[model samples]
Target: MSDSNTTDFTNPSTFILLGIPGLERAHVWISIPFCTMYTIAILGNFTILFTVKTDLSLHGPMYYFLCMLAITDLVVSTSILPKMLAIYWFNSREIDFSACLTQMYFIHCFSVMESGIFVAMALDRYVAICDPLRHSTILTNSVVAKIGLAVMLRSSLLALPFPFLASQWPYCRTNIIPQQYCIHMAMVKLACTDTRASSYYGLFVVFCVIGLDVFFIAVSYTQILRAIFSLSTKDARLKTFGTCSSHLCAILAFYIPCLFSALTHRFGHNVPLHFHVLIANVYLLMPPMLNPIIYGVRTKQIRDRLLRLFTHKGT
Candidate 1:
């Protein structure tokens, strides 16, 4: 009974969310940047979605995958930011325990889905460039739908265990989560129980989702480069590489900060807490903010349409 009492801080009614520990005095000021980021992400993603849906010329598999990406970005950004803003502006950080788990589930699910979309987009580029003749036949509307459904299922199933495992542990430590949002690792750390299972499972998911995605994306790009070099005409090579530039930039934007954040969380014990928090924020927020810009700048079709839309409206 004493041991039980000692270990079990079970069924915590609420948990406090620490927005930024070292910068609590400045959360009001920090919200300015956060608000700007949220605005850009929403507007950018919505524009992409609107452009893809309205433009019949963009009905190809590539754009179909891109539409899915835009939707995912919108859903992900919305899932994390509202309550976060509430914390910063209203000091409403005392979230119900159940609400935190729900947030974690969505955050994890959407992140995996986004990664899956990236892999799918890479494959789309590979076929479009490397096997242009068969691209249409291979990536029909039906196949694209299947890919979307499969990714959704994979992300949902894989992330389910995360919150389940978290809820199983009795929370003896402080119930304050040390991040802007309900991150899986941050929640897991507050549990007094042994975290070996959660750690290994998290690693397993990362390998299966992120590691495999990186490997396949790398292979697809390698084959694509080989195909481009083998092209007889410079014009043909330039066109093919140009088609891939937007996706490649988005990939770098999404992965680099994420890798750094993951490395810091695991190995950088001496790293400042604020630095870790900020890096994680970049990983969570930057890709959604930048992907639309990358696509708009690199893809002539998107840029031309956007410019024409604005020009027509101005007149």
Candidate 2:
């Protein structure tokens, strides 16, 4: 259905996001905490980026992927959190149709990119562990750069259909999006016309991209575990698992809530609205907040280098 046929166009061009239920009425109270979180997330991710870029010792396949993950986190969080803050603090819930679409597009794009980055991280671990002899040769700087570019391209392409399909839908009188940000599923649900096609297409994209990415990550870790256990020395096994423990935690932190959110949206809508909103936000915001800290605390080289860099300026 064309926009001309579906939407009245004479109606409001912008929509109100109701946000979460109890919080909507208490926007003032919530804004302070939300803003603080946004600041910390941005600052933390930026520190990782800066630390990795300037410190020569930190420049390796692991840190390269860490930098990419930081960049992705920054972009993704910035896309959603600022607008959410504006809505809560200033009562600025009116988002233009085009702007809404743009927001939805980037949310999808960055999400896919993050998934790809996780897979890439897994691949790095796989090479470092399973193919130890050729780890450096296989994950050379040029190769890492190429993989990063390919991840970006793949994510962009995968998300292209969402906005294109969304643009064609005629958004009639129902313009109230319950969430703070323009979520793709919520937007499609708001459309007056049949949205089965778009919904199914989205599901397909999610399964194909997230599913394949998770599968590869699982396989990489499986092989990694095998290599770790095969080591004759118990200390060697501990050391190997130690190197991957942080990434494993990060992967769980990212994927668990994401899969829960997706599943709840698809099969568990009979579940409470607050349940969905809470899980969705957790999936979106928690990883960005946790990723840098995880890498900084768990990775010895990164931790030592970051400490040195921070202490050097003070001295």
Candidate 3:
């Protein structure tokens, strides 16, 4: 048992993050790829944001949602990468109690927000391809704004419980977290009090947010596919399906690792802790780094705008 005098029963003063427990010797080497991914994520997402903002032709509801996605990806990565890099590079592993909770909140909150944005983007594509004439009228600026607000509110409110639940628990156990960052379950595990409620509620929130979002996206894609198939010409069908390819890539990049991480966390009892931590980091980093690349390469208008910008800069 931890000595009462040293341990803060209410909540510890700080938590020590063991950056990839099994890979301690490789921390420096690991920091190299993490830093590269983070730099790419920052530059790529910012490019997306800048290109979307400056180009009026690209200011459709689709791009607006893309901007929202870029911002969400930025937050999701920024929330943890710096601290993680610090842990790896500088041996700065200690994070304040309140700050840890805040980081945990931001990571989970923005992850849910990203999923919601995927649903919004899927709906945008569905309307665009399935009902082209009404797409503009359906996803007006005001409506898009409202949707963005709704996503924010939904993610924020649902994730609010995480930090609150974590903060209230008594941490008489060790303050050392096995992962590079403070995850909800990682923090909860340190609490001496009953944690079943936290665990179950977390699963509930996952279902309510991510599960619902995935279902909606799947439905949207189903209708989209049907619409594509209904097109009489083979060329028309391919063309329409091509429009969704980038978004589909983005969705896969974000969700595949995300779901795997979630499942591993909840059920993969035999999975290595380091592997779980790596997956969690990849889930956060990969989408941010890849989304802009996928969109820039796949979307013509944004690609042209980016080319012109770079050409102008070169001249």
* The best candidate in terms of lDDT: 3
Worst 10 contiguous positions by lDDT, candidate 3: 2-11
Per-residue lDDT tens digits for candidate 1, residues 1-315, read: 356446345778888889988899899998888789989999998998888887888888888888888888888888888987998899988888888899899988998999999999999999988888999999999999999999999999999999899889888778888887887889878988898989888878776679888999999999999999999999988988999999999999998887788778888999999889888888888888998989988989888888988899999
**True lDDT of residue 250, candidate 2:** 89
Task: Output the TM-score of candidate 3.
Answer: 0.97
The full ranking of all candidates by TM-score, starting with the best, is 3, 1, 2
Tens digits of per-residue lDDT, candidate 3, 115-162, equal 999999999999999899999899999999999999999999989989
Q: Candidate 2: which stretches are off by over 4 Å? A: 1-12
On TM-score, the leading prediction is 3
Tens digit per residue, CA lDDT, model 2, 1-315: 566657463344787787775557777776676676667779888988988888888889999999999999988889888888888777788899888888888988998999999999999999999998999999999999999999999989888888787778877758888888887898888787888988998898778779999999999998999999999999999999999999998899888988888889888958888668767887888898889888889999878878888798899
Ten residues in sequence with the least summed lDDT for candidate 2: 3-12
Where does candidate 1 have its weakest 10-residue lDDT segment?
1-10
Model 2 RMSD vs true structure = 3.2
TM-score of each: 0.96, 0.94, 0.97
Cα-lDDT of candidate 2: 0.86
Better of 2 and 3 by lDDT: 3
